[model samples]
Target: MMRRGLLAEFPTGDALIAAVRALHQEGYSRFDAFTPYPLPAVQRLLGWRRSRINYIAAFFGLSFALGAYLLQWWTAARDYPVIVGSRPAYAAPAFVPITFEMCVLGTSLSVLAALFVIIGLPRLWHPVFAIPGFERATIDRFFLGVDESDPYLDRDRTTRALLDLGALRVSLLGEEAPPP
Candidate 1:
């Protein structure tokens, strides 16, 4: 038998969040959400955690600055001390630009590297793509979905759950507005 998922859409963030919380209370854990713009309130309600990408990027950037400064100083002042064109071997001004650039470059590279390491980049496909009406997600729509894989999923029961949440209407994703 072909499996189906229930995708509930909402006109606003409040409605979507209310539905999400209600579903969570009903033990619906397997779901993914989409929104046209950020909703700080919903992020809190969903219990989303802070991403470590920023921390990792900052750390890498700091490390790069320190390493670049040390490498330049050590080579010019201590390893093979040589003053070029009457300039001070440890002149700080000359190092500033290169140090700043390296910091930015390293931070950007590592952030992208971390993204690939953490959330596989180039993810050409996802299971949710098989669910109908999901294409609206990129437009002016907000969606909270119950996957067919969810334990609580039964076509009738899921639809009933959506309706109970005061959904404008519940319908099979691509069925063009099912008889509610």
Candidate 2:
């Protein structure tokens, strides 16, 4: 059977931490904490996997840069053979500006595309936004939740559990989870 997500909102950081620890110890493997600012300790608690997009971006950027330079050399020197008043067949200095521009352009464009895909842009809406009292996550609240997608998540039980954990407020979000 499908299950809904549970969200807990805390009034203070200490409360947030305690609730997170409680959930973590309770054998809840799929959970996430959210706050207005960085919470460095959360990573240790969650143990998120390393992201490979950086390596991908580096590989793509380097390939693009080299391809840009080589393309310029081939088109200007060998392929098309443009003669600007006998200024040598392969004038490396003359090609510098366009080559540099293309390299920068290619790297920047590819990186931007990668970022859009990585971050899931153009569809920036999130399930957390639907949680009650969650709008304050940016202002002055801390939140934690078991995603509706979590296999072991039990909607009613999780919501009740969060409320008992000293949540200032508890609620559910997303189409899968009903509003509190």
1-180: candidate 2 lDDT, tens digit per residue: 113467778888778877778888887777777789877677567776666777766777677777877887898899998888889878888877776777677677877888788867877456666655677889899877677777667877877888888987777656644334
Cα RMSD, each candidate: 5.8, 4.5
List candidate 1 segments past 4 Å from native.
1-5, 80-85, 131-133, 163-180
Model 2 Cα shift for residue 52 (angstroms): 0.7
**CA lDDT, every model vs. true structure:** 0.74, 0.74
Q: Which has the greatest TM-score?
A: 1
lDDT string, candidate 1, 64-131, tens digits: 99998898888887798778889988888888888999999999999999998787777665554655
Each model's TM-score, in the order given?
0.75, 0.68
Q: What CA RMSD would candidate 2 show?
A: 4.5
